[model samples]
Target: MSKNLIYLLGSGRSGTTLLATILNSTMQIHTLGELHQVYSYIKEKLKCSCGERLEDCDFWKHVLSKMELTQEDLSTLSQAQNYEEQHRFIPFVFLGKNASSDYSKSQEILFKALASEKSTWFLDSSKYIGRFLLLKQLKFLNVKGVYVIRDVRGVIHSFSKKVQTTRGPLNTILYYLLTNIFGQICAWLFKDVVKIKYEDLIENPEETLHKVYALIDQRYDEIIASDFVMPHIIGGNRLKSNKSIAIKKDFAWKKNISRPKQILYYILALPIMILNNYKV
Candidate 1:
């Protein structure tokens, strides 16, 4: 049986986590938050959304046992993954080049272990075009991508806020532009890709989810509020740990961001914003 994978692609802070969490409510759909960061999380001894250390998580323990991977093997896999998913290696990946055979084989093994008969589709909210391209090389897995985009102003405002890793206005604009450019290219290059706006998702979640379900060839059902639970997600927004799920539009950017800076962001992102039909 072929393994089915659905990847979320685009810049971060675009509500991919919320989208994935909502989709996880659907039967037979599993969300693996930022699967690309699994090795890093393990290395750093980070915690899963389930509130257990990654190395100690029952789910990851099972995955490790199934893959039969040792600590040393994980170290090697991490190095290979880093090299393969680097921004510089993207062109090579697109040109059908494999940076490391070991990485490719390990990824195949990992996904095989993750895919079970019970689950029809696995969602990876990695949000990177490079990782998405790398996964496409795994022919045993049927891969589809959702390019999730948010308004540039909103993204800028989110990044500008004081956080652990805050980005300046210029950096935020550049990151948004570069990621979306590659994301758009990937979406166009692949037939099994779809685009979703964060605004639409917040305003009409049921309708937005129906579109995502269609992309992954899943039948849609009205999402039940009680079905929302913190799954065995690896790394994502802190909201994943919350017991309650709230769907609301965050228009705080309009109020908090300075008018001058907003105008500058608007001008810088005008082209892509226009392409995405995002207005000021």
Candidate 2:
């Protein structure tokens, strides 16, 4: 069976994790949240959504054992992955160049180990255009991209509240603009790509997922459930560990963000906002 890969392309806090989690509910789909961060998670002994440290998780242990990756190999692959993930390598990736053969090889091995006879579709919510572009160059897998967009105000608000280093409003807007601009370009470059709005996904999940499923030629099923088992994902938002999936839209930016910052985000993201049909 062919390995089918679905990559969610979007900036952080743009509902990629929510979409991935929802899609993971499908019997045939397996969610590998932020697969690119696997090395860091392993190195830091981060906790998986399954409530176990990555080094202790049976699922990850099985996958690492299957790939037969040694500690030295992990360190080498981490460096190679970091190299390929850099913004400079994007052009090379677009030209179908393998900047790091080790990264490519390890990706193949990791994905092969993740694939099973039952689950053919693997969802990687890495949200990096470089990774998406590089993965498209790989011939072993059938790759599809989903460009997820959210209202700039919401994104900026989310970024402001991030406990880790927060990208201030200006930086957040710039990052949002660049990511979605490139995301739009990615959609144009790949015929198998689909674009979905975060608002629409929350307001109308079944319809939105139907559009996503069409990209992979899969029949859409009613997979959203009240209780969801957190997949053995490596990196994603804290919500990944939550068992109950909520589809409620967050309008916090409307009240929480100051008027000036909101206006600034509106002004900075106006072009893409109009392109994506977002309202003030």
Candidate 3:
């Protein structure tokens, strides 16, 4: 492990990308977006936001080379039949372990190469609770967790509009409940876990990030916060393309999701929502 990995854990649409972009504003830290999807990168031949394919991007290519990852290794990682098995391999790769398994050795190279770079820290905003569990087994990483959460209604609203799925609203609400339930569990188990609210982030980025810095043992840099810039990110919300660093809460869910649906959401998410202290 690089001794500087900050893993962001949460469900999608919970502001992981937004927080990562904010952190990347610092020259001392580089935040890689959705790096957990490295297998997807290999499978889909996804293009980096910089317009070059992952294989061709200078930054990714360098990292891959340092990690000694080949197309074959990525394919093997992607081919893991069980989802839990796939996540179990994540921490070892970040630890730069040369384990017998290709998954562990490959990820170790990738993250170690990242640590070797100019930035003092690298933030992996993969947002998977399973990844957090896998990380617990590794001793090499100076790992800390930032559990980014948003209102369940807001997450459902965003997922409904942005994510194309056959799943219905009730299903969405159930998923929100379950994912967050596990996320909270991870936060409770992990040391130095920062339970951050997305609403808090947009309304008060400076204060929120200051708290995050404290969690990760990094000195808060005001200059970086003031003159924020989007660093080269791998895969995340399309909104990352927007150059403006303006921070504001997106409460569109309050107006977008009908009141009846909101009521239904509160009913379904009641247990976990109340557990997280989210208002009904």
Candidate 4:
């Protein structure tokens, strides 16, 4: 585990974060949220989830400036701070992009830190496979990845209501279709990759995560009771426009949104017909 990186790859609305949160609780497993900056770093004056600009937020500035912060530093800080503050250092929180990025240089900066950082497995819960592919090319061959999937209907629903993105309904659907399709293609392209259904994990978590953890070369003894049975719900946009890692019961995007949006989802998802045999 110490020699490898673990990535939870999926579309934006899928439940990659909760899985990362759970994995983060494991011994020597350091799970990072939305690390878009591994390829590029950006500074936005955007508001923090606490209604303050991220630039003005001392907590984030400290994290950004602090050189060589260890996994232990993140683990303790994340556990101690409010969820929003802890999440502030997330890659997306610091640097965000709607499209995939070329993070070769960023990977050099990040993985070098992780190699020496004290963690058995470094967890990445961003929903893009492009970054993973870029990292893979870096010759860091000992990497483990998970692809979490939610139904297309649910994903489009969540994307429509998001704050920072005001893409037209049609564009949202197209993005979902392309992302999922490319995601599946990447899953086929990568090694040591596993797939987890958001619904399956929610309905029968212990079994699903048992398999998930195993896929990443982690043992069951490392898991905690909190990871076993925590009822997760979703809410609150990132103070800086980010995606949720948890997909909760109330978040049935198909049931929650308007009919027009539903029709749009269907129309846009028509391309997914190629994956008719594909399981989500």
For model 2, the stretches where C-alpha displacement exceeds 4 angstroms are 258-260
The alpha-carbon lDDT assigned to residue 41 of candidate 2 equals 81
Q: What's each prediction's TM-score?
A: 0.94, 0.93, 0.84, 0.63
Compute the lDDT of residue 115 as modeled in candidate 1: 41
Look at candidate 2 and tell me the lDDT of residue 139.
73
lDDT of 3 by residue, 1-280 (tens): 2557778887778888888888788655677777667667756878776767777887787766666656786666655412443545545544553333444554565566674553377788877665555554455566788888888888887777744443567777776776677678767866678889998898888788788888867688764556456666777876566665666678998998888888878888788778778776
TM-score of 2: 0.93
lDDT of 4 by residue, 1-280 (tens): 2246777776666666566666656665665455543212223234333344433554334434433434554343333222322222334432432212323333443455443344367666655555565445456445777887776676666666645455655666666776667666656866678877777767776677677668766666645444222211112224223322343463566457777766655655765633543322
Higher-TM-score candidate of 1 and 4: 1
The lDDT per prediction is 0.83, 0.83, 0.71, 0.53
Note the residue pairs that clash in candidate 2.
none
Q: Rank the candidates by lDDT, best first.
A: 1, 2, 3, 4
TM-score for candidate 1, residues paired by index: 0.94
lDDT (Cα) of model 4 = 0.53
lDDT tens digits by residue: candidate 2, 45-121? 88888889876787888877677778898889888887788777777777777646787786887777774764468
Ten residues in sequence with the least summed lDDT for candidate 4: 227-236
